[model samples]
Target: MRDLVAAFGGELPGCDTPGLLGWLDAFSDEHWNFRGRLGGAERDRVRVELPPRLAAAGLAAAAALGLAGSGEPAHREYTHLLILGGLARSCLQRADHAARLAGALRVGGIAALGSLRPLSAEERALPGLGRCRTEADALAAGVRAAFGGRAVPVLVAPPGDPAAHRANTADTYEFWAAGAHPGPGDRILVVTSPIYVPFQHCDAIRILGLRYRCGIDTVGFDPRLAHPPQPGGAAAADRCLQEIRSAIRAARALLAAVG
Candidate 1:
């Protein structure tokens, strides 16, 4: 895999973030962080088959396993910009969907953002922010800045818990969405790291979609797992590996059922 990735553009591959960065070091493109997004036609196929399989999985998504790797709150935002900028733009090309997103943003559209941890100094200093500290601040600021008079994004973290974990944020979005959105046609775009997307979708559909009459679309923050190890332990690395593995198992099962 490393050799293939490095050979993609004739760059050297190490592992994880290093490999991605090494490729980028020799890479040139319109997009600096061009890690490809996951869960498209293939994901859709699995999704179509997944609902039926859920009953058998016992809701643990034991049906799905093998997935992980997301950076700090700020890193997530950075990744999101690379992925959604391209994706949302493509969806906008469709006049009907574009109009829907615009109208929804103005009235019924809700961009429900998951909670984030505190921003790093580097994150704060990133091109357009002033002094963003918390994940909510960064996301809220980012949403407003990006959509600008188009839509208002909300931080759906549980009260008193600004830094909710992945599992918790999955559920919180549904709660907030239920309140902020009521129109049957209301549109929701859930934003998070790519790895967390599947889990987020399952949680949202099971909780929010089942209860509310609305449309939901998700985009990964970024496609590459490029975050290097933190100071001490390999906890983050382990988690990312686990998540990848989990997503694969589930995705494979779902796809298999389709076949």
Candidate 2:
């Protein structure tokens, strides 16, 4: 925790993991969590824009926190490889990464998980994805592209009430488990974007590992290897900051669940 704070050149006197997580969560809430109080235009107006030096600092902090990795799984075999979904491009990228892993690792099965979240205009317009109307559709397309003749299940969670809330990481995990019924002896590997590793890994641990007693390992897809590639810049710093907040919230929830 101290190392992470120091990476951003910040000091927090004597704080443990939860303490530091809470501090960071509050900081992000103040600066970045602009959902409830700010409308779209107002949120855009109030969004924090990092300069080059601060952007570099954010990147450093993210790397220190394990949010910049595209690491390999610890084992060569698993009961299943679970690919978590995101935006149209992210669904594609993560699925493609999972396909590559399948060739090297012995897995009982592979599944791509997504929410029923509808695609945005920009997502629909991304090259080769015009037909996708929902997140699951893009995931299916990606799995098909990457794992040619292989049969991979593409699972979608239903939308939450007040549709804006959307189905999230936990929801997808729950949906997949209810159908797959993986046993306690099973080991599941998860694939997601590098920036989301910490938060999503926490969710998988809390939901799948704790409940089913199944082992959970999550890794991020290397953007350098992603098809179409992920963009980087000052915006990357903002994303890292946003996901740091996500990791904090997820950790808090996991603690509460365990307790």
Candidate 3:
């Protein structure tokens, strides 16, 4: 809590900052584990805040996953990184990290990618991306270039209306899921920004469990989680709360076609 306060400041709106500090100091693991522990909704409810929300979402996901990694692979694991993308400016970073993860993990399709948020005219004019009319195109080009257009094929999801983006996300997810052919016991990892982990995890678990009867693992790449700035990590992940909320809402739609 002190770290959070220090990272930001002692002043937080609607929060009894000092009192919250004391509350944190007094809170324990017992209280943490209590599922009934809840709080009332606050007033004002302005949604302009993004960074802290992302951070909070990441913390929620980490708690959901518990404190554990499968450890470095002894030989190879089915574990793969599913990257949710955002803008074109982030393509290079996300691509590089995906490559690094592929080098380390026995992933099937190398990487599955998506990001439809368009880049500004100025960003499009940048070298190597001048031809891309939208951010997803730039990301696909950047990711392919990261591997020198080698065997690493990046499945870039098509960008469009809210319904289209949701459909595209599910399509790309199914592509990777089928390509990997995960069985009942196999584990798949959903990789993206920390803020995205909860919603994406919800999508993956609900969809896969319904379709394949398989449990999966999810990880978020955040500055707090990854120090080296990797794809699916904060440096590469997009801060798209709108997209996040949409993804969550669509989790039901994703499974509606199924049983």
Measured by lDDT, the strongest candidate is 2
Clashes of 3: 1
Per-residue lDDT for 1-259 in model 2, tens only?
A: 4554565566765677678667777766765464423553211123556778766777787898899868989999999999998888888889889988999999988999997777888789888789989888999999999999998989878754455556789988999999999878999999998888999999999999999999999999887788768754412776777777788899988987897
Estimate the lDDT of model 2.
0.81
lDDT of each: 0.38, 0.81, 0.49
In model 2, the runs with Cα more than 4 Å from the true position are 1-20, 34-48, 160-164, 233-235
TM-score of each: 0.42, 0.88, 0.53
- TM-score: which candidate is best? 2
Of the two candidates 1 and 2, the one with more favorable lDDT, higher being better, is 2
**What is the C-alpha lDDT profile of model 1 across 86-186, one tens digit per residue?**
11211112212222234334333345344444455644664444565555565555555546575554544554444533214434654565556544654
